[model samples]
Target: MANIKKGDLVQVISGPTQARGGDRGKQGKVIEVLKAEDRVVVEGVNFVTKHVRVGQTQRGTKTGGIETHEAPIHVSNVQLVDPKSKKPTRVGFREDKVTKDGVTKTVRVRYAKKSGEDL
Candidate 1:
């Protein structure tokens, strides 16, 4: 599983999306996860060409041509957003090591550096 999963909101920090992308770079929700390639598809960013249908079943209507749609970006290029600050912040996992029934294990939790808050 990805350290960051689908449904998590994030900010694109690199590639075609950067400070230059402005509000377009402000916020995006993660819609898909691609672990093998370390990439995630943001809801409305990184568009690319796609063959499309104007209307799939519009009886005699002409089918649509190719259109653009969001493409995937590497996870390393995106940072989990900080709810309070509304800024792209890095995520750090804090593991609490404990012993139960004479067995030791760790529990991990996410944290944000900007506000020193645990997410």
Candidate 2:
């Protein structure tokens, strides 16, 4: 399982975005996780602009113009933010006993290594 998932808030640790200076320590939510490519699209991060043909349109909607959106960043470039500390921390899995409908079993749960709390 991926330590980072969709909707998880993350801090940029290192990457192209970090190299730019301003976004080095910025934190944003994960918009999409590309597991196969081991990359994630964080909200408001790694923005890229695409220019379209002026006369392009799909159906009744305009499809031509400059569009900006978040681009995928390597997973290693981000670190999960600890909910308790509000600081970036590493993620680790732990076994926990969970009971559902009276059936109890051990399940692996992701936790913040710094705070030892379930994520």
Candidate 3:
């Protein structure tokens, strides 16, 4: 598996209008992961539009708007943003040596290179 997983915080690293200084380093949380295409849908990020059937569909949640957000960005294009400093950071995966279980299991852990702190 890739180093990225759902519920992880990430940053807009490379993309149109995001490659430059403005939104390049803007932080967001990883909401979904499309592993087949190596894509990730960040929360409140990479917004797009979609048509919704008003009141015709109910998924046990509130319903609104005919056009909705729909955008799935490439996983490689985004970098994991550090939660503490709120800056873009690199993520690395290794066996969790200090896990409660005696068995070995790999975990997608991150460490801020600039701050030198484990995320």
Report every candidate's CA lDDT: 0.76, 0.86, 0.69
| lDDT tens per residue, model 2, 1-119 | 77999999899877555555546688999999999999999998888999978674556665678989889999998999998888899989999999999999999999988744544
In the range 16-72, model 3's lDDT, one tens digit per residue, is 565442445657778789988889888777666776655644556656576756378
Query: For model 2, how many clashes?
Result: 0
Candidate 1 vs. true structure, TM-score: 0.68
Error of 3 at 32 (Å): 0.6
Could you report the Cα RMSD, in angstroms, for every candidate shown? Answer: 4.7, 3.6, 5.1
Q: Candidate 2: list runs displaced more than 4 Å.
A: 16-22, 55-61, 115-119
Question: So what's the TM-score on candidate 2?
Answer: 0.83
- Greater-TM-score candidate between 2 and 3: 2
| lDDT for each residue of candidate 1 in 13-101, tens digit (9 for 90 to 100) | 66553556532464689999988888999887787899876765557767779988888887887888887788777777788888999
For candidate 1, the lDDT comes to: 0.76
Ranking of candidates on lDDT, top first: 2, 1, 3
- TM agreement with the true structure for every prediction: 0.68, 0.83, 0.65
